[model samples]
Structure formats: C-alpha cells, structure tokens
Target: MPEHHSGRARRIPPTLAAGLISLLAVLALLVTLPGTATAGGVKRPVHPDRDWMGVTIRAHEDGAGPSAAAQLTASVEGVDVSSHNGSVSWSSLWNSGVRFAYAKATEGTSYTNPYFTQQYNGSYDRGMIRGAYHFALPDNSSGTSQANYFADHGGGWSRDGRTLPGVLDMEYNPYGDTCYDMSASELVRWIGDFVDQYRYRTGRDAVIYTSTTWWKKCTGNNGGFGSVNPLWIPRYSSSAGELPYGWDFHTIWQYTDSGPTVGDHNRFNGSLSRLQALANG
Candidate 1:
C-alpha cells in the first residue's frame, strides 16, 4: 500500500506540490486570525444580530466634531429610538421639546423591533410628528427584500400631517465589514435599490440616515440620492460639521446619543411648520 501511494504521489509535478503547500499555509494563517475574515475586498466578521443606527459611528468616529452643546441655534427638537431604548415615554419627550421622533421598526429581513408599536404609536399619540426607520443590514439580503420587510412591519408612512416618511438608517455595519463587504459603487446600488423599492411601496421618498464619515467611506460620498432623499446626519457634536458630498443641507441632525430625555436627540433644520409640511408631503 505504501509503494502504491508513493507511485501515485510521484506523478504530481514538483512546482504544483510547492504551490499547494503555499496555498494551504495562507489558508491556515487566515483561519488563525482573531477577528477578521476576507470578503469582497474587505476584512471583517459577519454578525447577524440586529445593530441599531449610529452603532458603528459611536464606536469609530465619536468626538470628531464640536461638543454636542455647541449649536445653540433654534430648531425643532426630536429623538430616535431603537430596541435599545425599549418602551419610550412619548409624553415626557414631547413635553421636553421633542416635536418629532423616529422609532426603529425593522432590521434586515428578519428582525423587527419588539417595542415598535409602543414607540411608533406612542409618539404619535403624544402629538409628535413621528416616523419609522429601518436599520439596514445590506449583507444579509437584497435591499429590495429588506425594504419590503421594513415597509410591511412598521416602516409605513401616511400623509396624515402627523406621520413622517420612513427613514433608511445607513450607517456603518454593526456586525461585519464597515461597508458590508461591498465596493462603493455596489453599496450605492444597494441604497438605490432600497430607496426605489421603498418609494414604490409607500409613495414617499425615504429619509436617509447616515454619518458623514460612514457615507464617505462606504459610498465613496455618492451624491445620487441627495436629489430625492432627505439626509439625516448623525454627528454627536455641538455642530454638524462637514456633510457628505451630495447633500447641501441636513434635514435632521442627530447630535447626541445620550439625550437629557431619552434616546438620541436631534434637531430639524427648519421650523415646526416646515416639519409639518415635510410630514404632509
């Protein structure tokens, strides 16, 4: 048996055997690496759990701009809530000057916020012009599928003058590669897929929620959606420093994750009536 195997093994070329050994060594090295795996030109691990908006930004780019209290300018106040926030107090937020709110509804095609009904409905019940947002997980499924799941869950919009358009939370990936293992153009296409399908489903252009750093890094600062989608920028600083390339202005600026009230605090770029007009539209 040993002689038979030796005869067969000798049939391989010396160069091919060397190449096979080298490839196995490379594979072994990758497998031994602690926290990263190669996918589509990026190195990261896949975490299928739901990650809320701004998770990556808070991890990587927090404190890059002015303090959260720097901008004393007058604007409509708001908050964005996720499952992390649990059941939010709508009346307390409203009384504390939160005129608008966004509750996380869905993530990917698999997860929906358990507290969505209470947060989304409670804000509206308290007379806040509220919207629902989907925390996008582009790596798990096609953008169209995620959009459908989001709209079907709680991310629907109505022109009742009290309901705002749904938001697409497009920040950095909480569980995987920063750009979901996609190239910049590919990420742009995914976003287009989501917004286009969302508009088809709800007849409203979805608001895009992202930070400038993640936008520039992942999308290569693509400006295609800026013409139609309102930008929701997260800064966590006093001033919303530089915006991504496509947007001239931010519709909503999420300035702080730790608000005095609850969840992330935001400021609309316009007056209360303008906010209403946005809701009506």
Candidate 2:
C-alpha cells in the first residue's frame, strides 16, 4: 500500500484524486531536502558511533546539503514507503541508501494494497530486504478480520529469502467519521490480537508502527506490547537529545517526512541496525 491521503473514505471527485496524485508526485521529490551533517557546513561522513536516537531530521534544506555519500550508523537504516503510492521505484530508492523497507500489505479485511506484490517482489528481486505491514482497523469488529487478511494475503517473509520483520500499522484510520474515538485499551487489544495471529501463522514477530500521540492517547500507561515487540516510533519534531518515554527501545524512528529518493515525492524514514537485530531477536 503506497502512501495516500488519510481521508480517502470520504467521496472525492475523480478529478480530485487525479490532482492529488499529481501533487504528491511532485511534492515527493521537493519534500526531501538533503540531510546535512552539521549546520552551515558541507555534508560530512555519517559517524557510525553517533547516537541518532532523537536527531532533528529533514529531507531537504535551503542552502548547504549533506554530502549524499556520507555514511551514518545506528543499527538498521531503512524507509517505510507504505504512505507513498504504489508508483515508487523501490529498488532504485532502496539502493540509494535504504537498507530495509516495509511495504503496505493489506488495509482492512477487504482492502488489500494494490502495490503489495509489486513492491514486495520488486524489493526482493533487487536483493533489497523487505517486510510487509497491515493497516489495522480501529473498529473492534474488523480488527481481527483485517489482521487475518494480512496473514493470508501477505506473502511469506521467509519465502522471499528476506529477514525483514512484518509490521502492524496501528495509526489512527483517517477514514473514520469520528476522530480519535477509539480508547487506548481497545487499540492495544486490537494490535495485540493482530500480532498474535500474525506470529501464529508466520512464526515471526510483528513490529508496531505508531505515532507518539497515538501511543500516549490510545495505549495510555499500558506498555504490554512494548515488552514483546520492537516499536517503530513516529516523532516528527523532536531532536536527538529528547529521549522518547514509555518504550524500552525502538526498532525504527521516522525522524522526517522529507527524504531524498531517486523517484519518490513525499517523505522517507530512517532506522538503524537495531531494527535488524530486533527482527532476529
């Protein structure tokens, strides 16, 4: 599933969809400002030992840009193109710098991502490790059903000869009539149930992707899932100095929406080797 507008359920004129798609296509490339190593300086080599937990990230900048070839380290460095539409070139983008990627697999019970197989197979064929994610339903009745749909439809991670972990995208469903209506416990149960079933079928851990606000609001103090699975935390503004609370560790931190890619328009994500370690652990 490529990235799309959140409020897609509301009826939009066909013209609007085409216009939005074109807008996204252009915005994707312009949004990613070059990531500079230091302020007012040329791009420097990414220090493998530097702590990247809460770095202030941007995909592009106005003046000086980070040298494109500089290398940095954390653990696992990758991107999540689930939000990007299916038109992105996964192999070229991943080969640019991304070490691993997670593709959108299924959304609700009936809605499978149109690009799942293409991106999944594309990444695998290029020898870029990849994973799949199911956009979990916030509703109680459909949560389990959506999870099962992913398990059944999402191809085997092992079958592809890749080790990247599958993910359960637990963010708010933008299509809902009411905003932020689901309770914290309810979301946890929904997410937990999905992970349980996914593991049962795939024998692999399901990583959780959510924003700081969603986690704090929906899960509250309940960190039950944090103990068992690696979390992919999405914090848009915080700098590297501010440590995220509640979770013991995160597998990936989506630090910015602006990232450079050969043929992408919106944003990209970053992580460290810890992600791969989490997948193996």
Candidate 3:
C-alpha cells in the first residue's frame, strides 16, 4: 500500500504506481465513447482517456488569432508521474503536442518517487520542459526532517539550463486520523519552511500546488510564502475556467485530465511564456 505522510502524500509509491498501470489495463477494456460538442462548438470526446487525449487541430476561422494547431505548439495541462507514464518515455508526449510536465520528486524523509530521476532526466534529454514537486509534510516531528530529505534529493530542477520551477504539493494527507490536528496558521508555517529551504538550495522559486479546499483548510488565505513564488492551481472540470479565489496569477493551469499526448500512455499539458520567464528569472 502507498504510505501516507503529511508532506509526503502526493507521490505514488512503487506498488501504487504498479497498480495504476494495471488499472489502465482494465480501463482499456471499456467500450469506446464518442465526442460531444463543447461550449465553443468544438467537438471533444466524452471520455478522452480512451484515445490518449489526441491533439485537436483548429484553423484560423471567424477572425480568431492565428491557428494554434498550425503553429504546431499546444498547451499542456498534466500531473506528476502518478497520472502519466514514467518520465523517460515522454518524447511521444512532446511530439504529440504536450507543452509542459510536472514530475514527482520526494515526500518527507522516507519516500522518494522512484521515477523522479528517470522521468526528470528523460524529459530533459528529450527537450521537453518539465517541473518537479515535493509533497507538503504535515507540521509534526517529521516536518523539518522531511524538508531536509527533499533538499538532499535535489528536489527536481538542477542548476543547469532548465527553466521550469519546482512545485510544493500541499494537499492534506487524507489517511492520517490526526491530520487535521494542526491549525491553519501552523500548516502555512510548515509549508513556508519547506519552500524557504528548497529555494535556498535550488536557487529557483518553488511553485505551490493546491486545490481550493486544501488552500482554505490549511493556508486560510494567508498566501503562504507570499507572492514571491508562483502558483500552479489544479481545478479539473468540463469548463476549463478560472480559479475560485482571486489568487495570484497561476504559472500553470492544470485545466483538465483529458488532454492530447504522444503515445498511448503519456498525457498532454499546457503553460504560457510563464515557464520561460521563470527560467530567465
């Protein structure tokens, strides 16, 4: 079973990863579904998982901006290795129009995503822009120890030419019976400690990943670490709309689980010049 820790919950253990792979096998057996018309009149499949979220091509019609499909670069919205294939095989994703990726790094002291190095290095070698994430540790005896463990693992970005930033996964550990023991302020402080130490060593601003529920319960509108770091908000739904709160402008918008990809296993994702700006910063 996958171990659950406060700052260590986001990553999928080897056993869990193996289970997901097997789950996909079962999912493949489901009957194929057809596409439906979206609000924009764009026809999209009801269940995109069946087709690997194939890329959509649109022309510059009705006086819209230049056609994105013609440009050959598409926006990518994706999760870490828990959802997509291992990092090294992401070349198919790049070719299929995936614009960005986030790979799992470390969680607390005991667990590190086994695929982190393979995926991070592999994505870089294939010229795919990618980021790294550290699961937020809860405020307890293991908090700082987990932060040190992440620092030791190098978190994701190297001091090389890579541009994307590291991410701090801040969702609460649902499995812990006492997970709600910490007050909101305490949670903010714990997250801040992780970000501060990570930035000190990596020389890059670590981004924050959280949903509205987790942000409200833990951060309590404190905006942990302030506006100095970027935010990667995850809001999945049919609409691909704006974030709930008037939060800082997100660097990456994880808009959908349904996306285009290069191979049968990879996922599509999106981002703007935000990544370039971070790289130059």
Top-TM-score structure, candidate number: 1
Compute the lDDT for candidate 2.
Answer: 0.55
Candidate 1 weakest lDDT stretch, 10 residues: 41-50
lDDT of each: 0.83, 0.55, 0.53
60 Cα displacement, candidate 1 (Å): 1.0
Residues 158-228 of candidate 1 have per-residue lDDT tens digits of 88999999999997777667888889998998999999999999999999998888888999888898889
What lDDT does model 1 reach? 0.83
Per-residue CA lDDT of model 2 for 64-171, tens digit only, reads 233222233433456555434545676677666666666777655655566667777777676666777766555524455666787888734574345566777765
User: Candidate 3 regions off by >4 Å?
Assistant: 1-79, 83-88, 139-143, 177-180, 224-226, 238-246, 258-273
> How many Å off is the CA of 167 in candidate 3?
0.9
